[model samples]
Structures are given as structure tokens and as C-alpha cells.
Target: MRRKEDVVRGVAAGIAMAATAPYLTLKLLWLTGSHVGARDPKALDSLWTVNLLTFGMDATALALALSFVRPWGRRAPAGLVAFPMWVATGLLGTILVAVPTDALASLVLGPEHRTPDQPHLDDTIADWVFTLVYGGFGVQGLSLMTAFVLYARRRWAGLLRSRIGDLPDSPTRNVQRAFACVAALVALAVAGVRAYWAAGGEVGLPIHWVEQRTRSIATMDAAMAAMAVAATVATLVLVFRIGPGRRLRGPLTVAWLGAGSLFGWGGYQLVAFGTETTVKDLPSATPGLMNLVQAGQFTAGVLVLAVGAMALTERAVQREQPSSRAALSGTEPPRDLAAR
Candidate 1:
């Protein structure tokens, strides 16, 4: 069974690596000054930084995929492995869920696509670019997640199998609860704003973004809002032990993806918005408001991560206490008895 699982992980890692090719190739082409899909070559000139960032992201994803199957990954520090996977999960998980949902809605709802009569920045790119990039991202999300799940299970099977009620109260539990509440509140606020925008309320949006709002964009907003709420609820339940008997894995998984999306996309946009100029044709938001929103979103994600990490660390220490005591007393049990 273990060998079979390894084989499955190897295959998933390979697919994940293969999926990055088109996106990485596109970014590399753009960086090297090949206007393969650009409607205006000038539009490509200013996007070197963006292209470079995305190239690095895909490159990292490729490396991560390799790690799942490589021997070195098993020896890697937990923080090193988990942190990047968290970010990648957030980034790719959104693409995984949102793109397909948006596509389905478009198909069922007859596109409902609206464009400004005036030319926009995105109009400068060929449609195929969106298809290729987003399609590759969707594939990457699915396969990479598969690989990560298998890898995580092998490494942290006991923790993953634990229940919320199994977590012993610690001195830091209250503090984690307090921070989690704040993160939850922030997540809800972010969700409310995104939900508002998804519903076509344009109070804080830049005129350009309002004009450029399309079904897909709205769907993406709706998805983010949903993720925010889901992440909030999951984290709350986990920290508060709302469902005492419930397995830790379910809520943990939801919180992981939800928080990851919030941080990943929030940080991505924070950078983009921070560097943006009020250049015409590009969809943007009110700079100050957007900066605050993304920053808050990012902070909330970090808080969730901290709370979860603390809880896990506490649980791990508790799990080891018995064995550690037994070792000191020279009364350690046999392997099977120790596991019990």
C-alpha cells in the first residue's frame, strides 16, 4: 500500500511539473521580448516585472512538485516545506476553484460578458493567453494538491488523524483564540467588501474597475468572499473546539486553503497595487482603500497561520510528553505499546 501511494505521488508530481510548462514558457517568452501573444508590443514593455514574478512563481511550483517525490523532501525542515506549500496552495487553489466555476456559469448563463466600449489593457492580450495560463494553473492546482496531500499524510498522519477534542488546553490556547477571533473578524470584513463588489456595488472601486467588471471577475470575487467566510468558520471551529468530536483534518484543510487564498492573492494584489500608476486602460481600485484592504487580508491570513501553528505545536508537545517522561524514568515501553 505504501509503495502504491508512492507511485501515485510520483505520477502526480510529474503532471504538476508538466503543467507549469506552458505558463513558464509564456512568461519566459515575454521576458525575452517575444511578443507572441501581445496585441501591442508596447504593452509588454512595462510588464517585465510582472512577467518575472510569475515566472518565478511557476518555477517554484515546479520545484515543489519535484520535492514531493524526491528523497530530500522527507528530510526537509517542516517549516520550509509547509510555508511554501501553504502559499502555493492559496495561490493555485483559488485558480482551481474559481476558473472552472466561472467557466461553468458563463456557459450556463450565456457568458453575460460585458466590456467597456473603449479599449482596455486586457484587450491587448490574445484570448488564448488567458486560456493557456488559467488552464495550466487549474491543472497545477489539482495535481500539486494531490501530491502535497499524499506527502503530508505520510509525514503527519497522527496529527491529521487527531480530533479537536483531543487537543489539551494550554496557556496559549486563550491567546490563540483571541488572535483567531480578530482574524475571523478581519476575514469577514474582507468578505463583506468582496461580496459587495461581486454584487456590483462600486462604492470604493476605481472607475476603471467598475467599467471593466465582467462575469468572470465577479465570479472570482464571489469565490474569494466564500473562501474568506469558509476560512473564518473553519478556524473558529478549530480554535474554539465548537464541534468537540469533529476530526481536526476537515476544518484544518478548509482553513489552510481559505487562509492561503486570502494571503496569497492579497499579497499578490498588494504588490501590484503598490506599484501601479493611474495609467489609463488598466482596471484598478482606490489606491489607499485597496492597500488597506489587501494589507488587512494579508494580516488576517498570517494570524490564522500563527494560531493554527501554535495549536499544532501544543498538540505535538502533548503527544510527546508521555514518551519523554518514560525515557527519563527508564521505563519506556515497547514500540507497539508506545504507539498506544
Candidate 2:
């Protein structure tokens, strides 16, 4: 059973790592390009490639998440609420709002339209798509961050109040807390920026015109990138702390893979932001970076899903073993049955 679990975790981790490579490479290419034209044939090709990669990653995440249901004793009430909210926000904001806006803007405005310029038919549609999709993603991210923070806080409080003496803080606990905080902050910042844009107002009051507008957005992007890097590093450190042992190997391995996914995804977010922001003639780099970040995030999401799956599987196996279940549950069999 232990060996089987390890195999399952290893395969999942390998798939996640493989998914990140192309996505990351494309992002780096765009970032370093002397001139990256969004409408350029090459840029479009890169975009399609990233889309394909992310599709695969998302599929994997869904599969892994499904696998966890049996053992986790069905989805927890909290997860039930949180997961749907995250998915809905992601779909609505990205597909419904952001994508259409960006596509219309590109088609009608010939890829050069600025806000308030009464974009061409195609440009207008594109703008609407971009607004909703990106906005949705940002909202979804905020929701997940909030959920994770609450979960971590609960765990921390339980640990502190428990009778388990000499329980030193694990690296996993510390990293998880750090990630929760960073995720929450990123979500807040993104939300604030979106709100500012929605109100037909830009940040950096009065000096909003000229280079300041671009600079202010760039600064926010940079800050997000830095936090992502920190989170990735912290997650990796936690991964290395998984000790070697037969019985403990499966869960540890799954957790490690999940951490790796987080690291890759977080790192990619930073790179994608840098590439998009620094590109010349780019409308803010958000569009170009979308697919890349999605790929990384999906990959990380899969690993986390795998962790849940392993936990569920363990629970299922335990239930099947009546002796183990009886011991843990403290339920004794009838004396007559025992005698028989």
C-alpha cells in the first residue's frame, strides 16, 4: 500500500513538472524579446501553445481532486462552499468578462486602442472579455487565499490548545501560514486595482497621467511577483522536511509534490508579470501572461489535489481494515461473536 501510494504521488508530481516547462519557456521568451507584438504571428502561436498546456494541467487537477473524494469522507462543508465559489469566479471573470473585452479591443481597435478611446467593434469586444476574465481570476484567487488563511488559522489554534506536549512547529505549518498571508495580500491588492479601474479612476492621484499610471501598475505587479517568489521558496523548504519512512512515505510524498506545484506556479506568476509589464507596446502585459500563469497555477493545483486524494485513500484503506478501524474507533465486538 505504501509503495503504491508513493508511485501515485511520483507520477502526479512528474506530470505537474512536465506541464510547467513549456509555459515557463514561452513566458521567458516573451519577456526577453526586443519587441513582442501581441498581434504578431509568433506571439499568437505562443499563446495557443500555453493554452494547450494549461488545458492539460487543469484536467489533471480535476482528476486528482476527484480521486480525493473517497478517502476524505466526502468533501468537507468548507471545501464544498469554497471550491464552487473559486471555480465560478474564475470562469465568470475570465471567460465572461476579460476574454471578450480583450478580443473585441484587439479586433476593432487594431490592437492599439487605449481606454476611453471608443474602441473599434472588435476592440470593444476584446476589452470586455479581458476585463471579466482577469477580474474573475483575481476574485477567485482572493477567495482561495481567504479560505486557506481561515483553514490555517484553525489548525494553528488547535495545535496550540492541544494536549500534545513538545509538539514543535513543523516547517509545513509555518510555510502554509506564510503562503496564506501572502495569498491574502495579493488578492487584496489585485481587488483594489480592479476596483480602481472599474470606477474609471487610476491610482497615484493627480499624477495619474503620464508615466505614473503605468508605473503604479508596474509597481503592484512587481510586488506580487516578489511575494510569489517568497511563497514558492517557503513551500519548497517545507517539502524537504518530509522524513523518510515506509508508513509515512505516501502522505509525505503527496505533500511534497503539492509544495513543488505551488513553487512552480508561484514562480511562473512572477515571471509572467515581469514579461508582460516590461514588454514594449504591450497594453499592460496582462493578456500575454494569462495563459502562462494559468499553466503554472493549474499544475500547482493538481499537486494539492493529489494531497487530498492520498488522504482520502488512506482513510478508505483504514476503514476496510476492520481490526484497525475497531482499534481506532474503540468499538468492541459482541462476546458471542468473538467466541465464535
Candidate 3:
């Protein structure tokens, strides 16, 4: 019998693991007082904390990449592996598409975006080091996603079979519908903010607003908002199966990515705030109007995350029910007999 799982994807995961090493190493060096990439000698805050936070993120990616290639990952609890990977996919998926496009745009348009003034790398070999780090992130994203897909396809074909619009009777349906509706509204509000920001309308400004006026920041903010809105709406549509034809693939993908970005980034930021890593980025005194925006985004992200999780769980349970019935009646599934 052929051994299950592609050996090739395993190798690809190894490559991804290796790709993350340089970034992790550089961060380690920085944490220990090496400042090879430092641009400002007197940067407003110590970068050690940020470096550690980034290192942990990359480390998680490394572990995830390894899981795809190894037998151990298959043996582990499926949801445990799946959730972080899903979150990573959402966050990294956006960057995987955006960064290269941004690079290309900068080349053609001659660097129209405003670069952050502080915490920059020197524009030389040091900068290339930072590039390697970010480049590793993109590579980790693409490689891990490819590996996960191959792994999922081979391992659980049945659970993957449902169409997007299929609605089943669930005890949580009422709760999910209410949550999704509220979440969708919040996401729309965020999308509006992003649009306004993209168009250069500043409703609530901190002093930092002046620095964010560059084409790059506006474009990025707009893109994030638009994408989040798409995902949010798509998720709500999928959850409610709203007035639909087969809108599964596109909407499902959008919802997955959008939920991941919002949850992963927002959750990370919230947690990182308690740590030294994010304190440098946190606003002082008043929580500000942006906090409201963030709160909405976070809520939407979380609710949609619940929607996706429940959907996947239901699919898995559906697959197992037939087997459970046969076993309880002292018979085996047809495939189980064939295997023996």
C-alpha cells in the first residue's frame, strides 16, 4: 500500500523551517544587544521587546511548517493544529499577496509611500537583513499553506465536500446568526473608516496622523479595510446562507482570510500590550476613537472565527456519525472491513 501524505510537501515544510531560521537568529542577536540593523541610535524605545515578539511569531510558523511534514502532526489533535494554522493563513495570506505587489508598485511608481521615520534599518546590507526576515515570513506563508492544503485534502476528503450554502440544523444557529449579524455591522463600520482614511479624510487625529499621509499608509489602510469588509460580509453570508446561489469558494476564502487577520492581529496586539513588546506602540491616556474601531473589528473577527470553527466541527462530526452508528450496532463501516 502507498504511504499516505505527500513526501514532497514534507520537504517543502523543511524548506520553510529553514527559511525562518535567519529571521529568528537576527532577532536573537538583537535581543542580546546586537544592533546590526538599527538606523536610529536613539530610537524612542528599545527594540528588544519588539524583536522578541516577532521572534515568537516566526517560531510559531516554524513549528507549523514542521507539523505539515511530519507524522506527529497528523497524530496530534486536529483542531489544535488547525486553529493556529488557520490564523496564520489569514494574516500571512494577506501579506503574501500584498508585499510583492507593493514592491512592484514602488518600483513602477518610484516610492510614493511615506516610510516610517523611526525603527528603520540602514538602507544597505542591514536593510537586506530585514528584507530577509520579511521575505522569510512570505515564504513561510506560501509554503505552510501549500503543505496544509495537501495534508488536508489527503487526510479528510469527506469533511471538505460540503458546498458553501448548505445549512444544517444546529443548536447554535440562532446564537450564531445573531452574533454574525452584529459582527457584520461592526465590520462594515470598520470598512467605512478604512475607506475614509484611504480618501484622506481624517475624522479623529492623533499627532501621528500627519506622518501617515503618505500614499503607502493610505493604500495599506484602505486595502486592509476593504479586505476585512469583504471577509466579514462573506462570512455572514455563509453563516446565514443569505439569499444565495453557490457563493462558496470565494466567500468562504474571503471569510477565512479576513477573520484570521482580524482575530490574529487584534488578539496578538491585545496580548502583546501586556508584554513589553507592544507597549511602545500603545496609545497613552484616552483609549481614543480608534479603540472603538479596533473593538468592532475584534468582535467581528471573533464571531466569524466562531462561525468557521463550528462549520468545520459540524462537518467532521457528520463524517463520524455513520461510523459510530455501525460500531454501536456491532457492525463495521464498509471501508473498515475492506481495510482489514
Candidate 4:
């Protein structure tokens, strides 16, 4: 069984790494002024920074895919391996869910025509670019997520099996509750805004943004909103111990992916187009309220992550107590609590 699992992990990691090549190559081409799939080469000039950032992100994904199968990855510090994987899962996972839904919606609704002023996805990018890049991202998300799950199960088997009610109450429960509440409110706000936009309510959007709305854009908005809600629900449940008998792994997985999506995509947009970027000609709000909302989403994600980390750390310390006592008394700790 172990050997079979290892083979599966290796194959998945290989596919993930293979899927990055097209995206990485395209980003590199753009960065080097080779407009391989760009409609207007100069249109990409202002997006050099965005391209570089995405390139680095994909490169990191490539490295992570390798780490998923390599023995050294097992020995790496937990945080070092987990953090990047979480972010990768967020970015790619959102794409994985959105792209197919978008395609189906497009098929049902038909394609919307856009004016020259509106920034449609195909405005600056070629048709083939979306196909190649998104297809790669989809494959990468599926394979990388699979590999990570297998890796995590091997390394943290006991934690995965533990129930939420089994965890000892943290001394900082009040603090956790406070942060969780704040994070939940922010997530709901973020979800509300995105959901409104997805449903074609355009109160806060610039004219160009409203005009540029397509099935794909709407699908992405809906996905982000769903992720925000999921994160909120999962985090609140875990923090408040709402489901006493629930396995810790389920909520943790949802919280991880949801919070990661909030942080990863929110941060990407905030950095990529939050400032004076020519990527999209968005309308001007009186005080950049939309930007603040984006920042708030990112902040909420951070709060969720911090609160979850604190809870897990407290649990880990408490779990270690029995083992430490056992060592001192020259007796073995329960096998169920044994380190993976």
C-alpha cells in the first residue's frame, strides 16, 4: 500500500510540474518582450510587473510539485512546506472550480459582445492564451492538491483523525473568538460584494467593469464569494467548536482552501491592479473604496489564518504533554498519539 501510494504521488507531482511549463513559458516570453500570445505587444508593457509576479508564483508551484514527491520534502519544516502549498491550492483551486463552471455558463448564456472601451479578457490576450493557461492551471490544481493530500496524510495522520471536541480548550479561547468574529464579518462583506456583482448588481463597479461583465467574470466573482462564505463558516465552526463530534480535518481543509483563496487572489488583485496599472481601465471611485474592500478581504484571510494557527499550536502543545510525561516516567505514550 505504501509503495502504491508513493507511485501515485510521484505521478501526480509529475503532471503538476508538467502543467506549469506552458504558463511559465508564456510568462517568460512576455517578460522578455516576446509577445507570443498577446494581441498587442505594447499592451503588455505596463503588465510586466504582473507577469513577473505570476511567473514567480508558477515557478514556486513547480518547485512545490517537485517537493511533493522528493524525500527532502518530508524532512522540511512544516510551515515552510505548508504555507506555499496553501497559497498554491487557493489560486489554482479557484481556477479549477471556476473555469468549468464558466464554460458551462457561457454555453448556456452564449457569449456577450463587449465594446472597445470595456476590458474583456480577450481584449489584450489571444484566444489560445486562455485555453493554454487555464487548462494548465486546471491540471496543476488537480494534481498538486492530490499530492499534497497524500503527503499530509502520511505526515499528520493522527491530527487528521482527531475530533474537534477532543481538543483541549485553549487559554486564549476568548481571543480566538474575537478574531474569528471579526474575520467572519469581513468575509461576509467580501462575499456580499462579490455575490452582488456576480448576480449583475453593479452599484459599486466602474462603467467599464459593468460593461465588461461576461459569464467567465461572473463565475469567478461567484467562486470568490463562495470561498469567502466557506472560509467564514469553517473558521467559525472550528473556533466556536460548533460541531463537537466533527473530525478536525474536514473543517480544517475547508478553512485552509477558503482562507487561502481569499488571501491569494485578493492579494494578487491588490498588487496586480490595485494601483495605477493599465491592465484594466476601471472607473474611479471617490476614495478608492473598492481597493479598501480588496484590502479588507486580504486582512480577513490573514486573521483567519492566524487564529487557526494559534488554535492548532495550542492543541499541539497540549498533545505533547502526555508524551513528555511518559518519557520522564519511562513508559510509552499511547500509540494513537504517536508522531507520524
Residue 24, candidate 4: C-alpha displacement in angstroms: 0.7
Off by over 4 Å in 1: 113-116, 277-285, 331-340
Clashing pairs in model 4, backbone N/Cα/C closer than 3 A: none
Question: lDDT tens string, model 3, 16-105?
Answer: 888888888888877777766665534413545666877787888889888877778877787778788878887787677567767777
Mind sharing the TM-score for model 1? 0.92
Top candidate when judged by lDDT against the true structure: 4
| TM-score of candidate 2 to 2 decimals | 0.31
Candidate 3 residue pairs in backbone clash: none
lDDT by residue (1-340, candidate 2, tens digit) is 6456445544543443343344344444444552232434454454554545444544433433333323341234545533433333232223333344545656775644246643232321234433433453444333333333333233223322322222234434444444444543443443344345444454433221222344223333333333334434333333333332223323333333333333444444444333443545434334433444434444444444443334334433443466556668899733322211
**Highest TM-score: which candidate?**
4
lDDT, model 3, position 73 = 82
What would you estimate as the lDDT of candidate 1? 0.85
Structure candidate 1, residue pairs in collision: none
Tens digits of lDDT, candidate 4, 1-340? 9889999999999999999999999999899989788787777886899999999999999999899888899888888888899888888888888999988877888877667676775877899998998888999999999998988888888888888887668789989889999999999999999998889887766666676678788899899999999999999998888889999999999999999999998898889867664543335332365677688778988998799788878877888888899999999987866544
lDDT by residue (23-142, candidate 1, tens digit) is: 999899999989998988897877888888889988999999999999898778878888889999998988777888888987888856444575454777998998898988888999
Ranking by TM-score: 4, 1, 3, 2
Per-model lDDT: 0.85, 0.39, 0.69, 0.86
Error of 2 at 307 (Å): 15
Higher-scoring candidate on TM-score, 1 or 2 = 1
